[model samples]
Target chain A: MAKMNLLQAINSALDLAMAKHDNVYSFGEDTGGFGGVFRATSGLTEKYGKHRNFNTPLVEQGIIGFANGLASQGSYAVAEIQFGDYIFPAFDQIVNETAKFRYRSGNEFNVGGLTIRTPYGGGIAGGHYHSQSPEAYFAHTPGIKIVTPRNPYEAKGLLLSAIFEKNPVLFMEPKRLYRASTGEVPEEEYTIPLGKADVVKEGNDITVLGWGAQMEVTEKAVEKAEEDGVSCEVIDLRTISPWDVETVTQSVLKTGRLVISQEAPITGGFASEIAATVQDKCFLYLESPIARVSGIDVPYPLCHEKEYMADHLKIYEAIKRSMNY
Target chain B: MAKDKKHNTEIVTKPKWFDKDSVTIPMLQILKEDGSFHKDADMPAYDKELIVKIHDTMQFIRILDERMIAAQRQGRISFYLASRGEEAASVASAAALDFGDMIMGQYREQGALAYRGFTVEQFMNQLFSNEKDLGKGRQMPVHYGCADLNFMTISSPLGTQIPQATGYAFGQKMDKTENCTICYFGEGAASEGDFHAALNMASVYKVPVIFFCRNNGYAISTPAQGEQYGGDGIAPRGIGYGMKTIRIDGNDAFAVLKATQEARRLAVEENEPVLIEAMSYRMSGHSTSDDPTGYRTREEEAEWQAKDPLDRLQKWMMNEGWLDKDHVEEHHAEVKAKVLAALKESEKVPVPHIDELINDVYDEPTDMLKEQLDELKDHMRKYPDTYSKTSGRLD
Candidate 1:
């Protein structure tokens, strides 16, 4: 095992997958020799040879289309979208072609060997274009698995599992935690089962649920809530689609209250989905209504990043509200 | 942006408008109208088996289009798109490639699919959306795909496969397979952003992909002349991207075969992407939903009907003693009968079970999918009149 950041762990996972399978290819804008804008694919071109790992023209739709076509040939395509915000250009390909490739063809053709990796969430102060969490948009799309990781260990495990999952997967990496989040990761290959939620901390008063960078924020909020004589259970939802309902509902049933947070807008945010589902399952068991502490339904602001974000303070306030009710 | 090289050739003393019509790319027409070749034309070097296959696929497409249009009239299928006049543009080009090469065709390229060995039964099953259909009744009629045959599925969205072909060919190059890929789309589809994105990327990446643009006169209701582009067709776009480009008489089967053969050579031998613009006409309406009288003139349709690709190919083959009138008649009759039989047999087969509805959403249905399926089934059971009458599987 080695101590690595989220980016390193992701790179290690790509390296491991490419090493294990020659058919595994990784490419995108600036993802080749430059190792991506975030260097998430560093050293891959040299290690795997430029043929398999190379740069593509700066067209997001082209990248996804190319990846889909290659994956249709029974190859593993690991396509990187430069930024989650830029992935909109490829939205039709993902929602229509990639997701429906298997379903539309009745399993005769599939891009199941394809994994689309994009960095999501806001923290770098990169403004609108770079800082955005688009996971909610894809989570609503069926036929594709959506996975996000909170830390280094989870990043490596979930990413490996996505590549081998036999269904097109959208792996959203929390760019905000690329370097800020680090931990010991096993060098030996491993896979974390998708659609499973990991309970970071056990508590009985209230459940704080989030994924990716929000996991850390929720953990901090749980600490703040503890000071207020409230015990909160923290859950990291690794897979957004096919999310672990049993684990989350069980957690909500035990705590009798739930607060979900995300960087995306609250209106159609993934947090809203979780909050709605929790209320439906634990309706009679609830002491307070489900609270969604997420970003406002506006463009992500560059200057007011702290205020716009559902930071620990905002989540802490929401947890206190859930407890007060 | 295209004038930097002009400055190097000569200093501009006075401002002048560039004449777009100054350059005209000639269409490659080896086979002339009356069953003979142009004076200096060379016969395309193809095995007799391949020539026969291309001819047979064209005949198959002609029969399929005619009967399927009648089928649509009878309300047997929801929709159909006929490759009416652009047969050689699709089939001959398909005949030039190896079976390992990938074919990403638009909806009208059933000729190419047939050339790649898609059977009449498979075509009928897809059109009927029966249980035996490879698409599992998921897509509408005319959307066909066979991965085993290296033919990517037909998609409704125009030009989405253009960039996809570049990526697929890039994989072929990476695998060192000594193969190439062919992407087909119409002049109307060229207006899509994917067309520009695909051309620029294929050229920049130097992937072995042939972008075959069937410059059929209309894109549904939009004419290609002033609507699609102002410049000389899609051929110049290829030159602008610094790749080999060719324009061919799409109705001339020999020209299409020769152009594609040369393009494949450049692709597989040198890893160079090539673009071939085949000039043809959409003799029929875009799909069954359209009516040509709404947008085009009868005189215009008559002009292209005279250049019917099937008739031209038959004339050339007969003049060369490669075909007999009796054999050709027998072949057409056989194709019609076989297509009708397949249509009758396939439509009688039941549609896929209701369980298949949620099967390929993923390798295994998720909990959400399973729960949703249960809810749907209960809802269907409650309201059987609307579904069971047509599907006959609610119970």
Candidate 2:
């Protein structure tokens, strides 16, 4: 085992997947020698040569659409969308074709064995252009799996799982945590099952659930609750779509309270989904109504990064509200 | 249909329809104007049953277009896109392929889906966005995907399917499946960068893929005359890609089937990619949401209707005694009953279960997804009076 960051784990997974499968190739804007703007694909071109890892045009539509074609033919493709904000151009390809290819053609043509890696979520003052939490859009879609990792260990495990899975996957990486987050990741091959949540810190008072970058914020909130003589269980939801309701429900049932957090807007945010699930599954056990800590229902503010984020203070406040109820 | 000369608009003249240019392939027409077979034509042999099948499918498609469009107007369905005058192109090309071959179609190629034996019930279920839709009522109407049929779901965006088809064909080549992927798109989609990349990749790798272009005169409001490249419709570009290419009379079933069958042979057996350009007309609005009267003329529509592919095929079938007038009427009635019954069932089908929204993306639902599903359940419970029926099924 070795300690790694989100960026390191992602690169390692790509390297391993490419090495293991000859048909696994990758392409996107500046993914070749430049190794992507974040270097997630850094050193891949040098390692596997340009044929397997190369740069594509500046067109996102072309990149994903081409990946759809390549993946359809039995090639395992991991296409990069430069930033989550710019992925809209390729949304049609993902939502219309790649996601539903299996079910629409009655499983006649499926791109299930493909992965789309893109950086998303807000925190590094990227404003509206570079930062966004668009996973909900994909999570709303069927046929495609959506996953995001909070730490290096989960990153490596989930990436491996996504590579080998027999369905298309939207692998979102929180750019703000690429180098900031780290954990001990195994050196050899291993995979974490998708649709599972890890209880990072267990307590009896309440359950704090979040994913991607917000999971760290959620941990801070739990810590504050602990300092305030309030015990809280914090769970990191590593994947978004097909998320783990069983763990959350079980935790909430024991705690009798829940607080959901996300960096996306409050309305129709991923948190809403979680809140709904908790109410249904553990309604009888609940001592308090579910509380959500989310970004304002407005475009990410350019000058107010701290305010726009569902940071420690907000999560703490949400938890306090849920506990009081 | 005679080429319009009154406009005298020679935007870019490289190759006229019938002229021989190594750079530009002519529209392969097996049946001459007099309805006689052409000499030196490598056409597909069509027995009486196959001809009737092709004609029946076309007639059913036309009826489907009428009924569905009317249903949309009546608010029975959300939206629809008709195959209309392009029936021959889609049906003929689809008929030419092996049963196992893959079909990647744009939204307008309903005829191809129908030809693949996609039942009227399936079409209605998808159009009605009901629970029975294989898509689980997740997609907008007209975006049909059938897993068992091997017909890739129709995507609304113009050219996304081009590269997807290429990638799928690459898989076929790897598996040694001897099955080629035929991607159907309008000439306008040729302008998209995906089209260029797919062609380049398929050519370089020599993947088993057929790039089928239905040049139906217009892509929405943009006509093919100006919207497509200057040389000649879209055939020369195929030649420029260094792949075998052919242009065919889109209204002539014999020509389209002949060209497509040969293209599939080269694609599957030889691992060679090919492009087939079907010259046709858009006899209806691009879709239910569009109003073609704004850009096109009735005179133009009338002239194109005179060259109706179904009528010509019917003439041939009737002349050959393959189908009688009474049989045609009976077939129409039978297809109508099926389409109507499917429509009624689809309209009554409920939306997919709420829990299904979180399923299928992974082996099991993740914590975040669980949370979301929980939230929805809470909303439904909170508004208990609003969700009494829906909530009861939670168990």
Candidate 3:
């Protein structure tokens, strides 16, 4: 086992996946000699040569299209969109082509070995341009899978799974947590199955559900709640698309209350989906209405960074509000 | 990876740099514009039955377009895009390819799908957005996909399918299949970043894919002259990407077939990517929702009408003694009847079962999806009058 940052873990996963399969290649804007904006593909082109890893025109649609081409060839492709916010240009490729290939083709043709890597979320004050949680848009799209990680260990494992999965995987890396989030990860190859959640802390009063950078805030909130003599169980939902409803439901059933937290806007966010699910499946056990602590419905605001952002303090207040009844 | 500067210059050689024959492939014609054959020029000598069959399909598609456009105007449908002047580009190209070869199409290639045996009923079913529709009303009209026919569904975003075709063609090569994927887009779509990316990858990997561009003079209101940069059209960009390239009169069905045939030979046998630029015109509005009179003059439309692809094909049939006025009128009437009946039936059919909305996403719907489905069902049950049209058995 070794300790590494999310960026290094992601780079190692790419290197391992590419070195293991000659058909595996990578490319994006600055993904070649520059090793990507985040250096997730650092040293890949130098070692694998340009045929496998290279830089491309500053076009997101092209990068995705090229990746789709490689994937169709039975080649595993790990493509990067400079940032998550810019991926909308390639939305046609992801939502229209990549997502519907199997269903449209009557299961005759599908892209099982493709992964799109992008950095998402806004804790680093990336402003509106660089920061976004667009996973909800893709998660709603069928035939595509979504996975985001909070720590290096989950990042490496989930990425490997994404690389090997038999469908298009939108892997959103938390840009703010690339270095802020670190943990011990095994050098040996392993994969964390998608559609599962991890319970970081055990308690009975309420289930504090969060993902990506928001997991850190939820942990802080749990600590503060503990100091207030309010025990809370914190669950890190690593995969947001095929979210681990089983884990979340079981926790909700036991805790009898839920405080769903995410950095995305509260309206139409992942939190809303989870809240609706808790209301349906565990309503009988609920002591209070499910609460959501999230960014406002407004777009990731550039003018009031601290005021609109979700953090431990906001999470604590929401939890208190849910417990008031 | 090495940028071939000389090769690039050679591809961009202006038409002024070459004689007419050097630039334009001699169009394959069974008849002249006056409905008479040249005695000396070599002909492929297609059988009478096959010639009539091709004519029948073309006439049927033309009639279908007329009715569908009328339906859209009547507000029975949301939108419609017609092949209009470019039917030959689509129909003849489809006839040339093997059924197993994949097709990734833009909105205008319904002629290709119709020629490939996509039933008129299936077309109406999808267009009317009914239960029989393969997409189950999930998509807007013209976004057709048929798995059994190997035509990938049409996407709305311009040029997005270009790279996807490359990827799917690569998969065919990997499977050691003789099939190739044909992606059809307009010259307007060629300017998109995806087009450049798709061609670059297809050339680099030598994927068995054909990038078919219908360089139809305009992208809606923008004329090809100012909107795109290829002096000769989209063909040069294919060469720039190191792929095999060809240009042809898209209105000539024979030319489209010949170009696509040779392109298929390279893609299937040589694992090469080929780009075929079909010089054609968009005679109708970009969509039923558009008004082309705002941008183009009647003179421009009249000029293209003189080169009408349907008339040219009919002339060729007449010269071959394959079709006459009576036969043409009868075939036209028969196709109209078929389209009208299909449209009536399709509009009457119900939408897909409500449960179908949540099915096929996973082996089993996730608990969350199930929960959501339940909530929707409960909401419907509670408000039966509100959802009376859709609250039926789930498929």
Per lDDT, the best of the predicted structures is: 1
Error of 2 at A285 (Å): 30
Query: What residue pairs are clashing in model 3?
Result: A69-B167, A72-B167, A72-B171, A73-B170, A112-A166
Question: Model 3: runs farther than 4 Å from truth?
Answer: A1-87, A90-325, B1-45, B392-395
Residue A135 local lDDT, model 3: 83
Error of 2 at B260 (Å): 0.6
Question: Model 2 segments beyond 4 Å from truth?
Answer: A1-325, B1-22, B32-36, B384-392
Q: Over the stretch B1-395, how does candidate 2's per-residue lDDT look in tens digits?
A: 43558885644456557443545456789865444568888769677767777888899999988999999899776567888888999998999988899999987788888888988888888777666788766555678888788988765556889999999999999998989999998887787778888999999999999999998887665566732444578888887898999999999999998999899899988988999999889898877866777557899999888778887777767777787799889999998998888788778777666676656657787777677567556545644554543456654
Q: What is the TM-score of chain A alone in each candidate?
A: 0.99, 0.98, 0.97
DockQ of predictions, in order shown: 0.02, 0.03, 0.03
- Tens digit of lDDT per residue, candidate 1, span A218-243? 88888988998998899999999989
Candidate 1 CAPRI assessment class:
incorrect
DockQ (model 1, Cα): 0.02
Question: Candidate 1's residue-wise lDDT over B148-175, tens digit each?
Answer: 9999987665677999999999999999
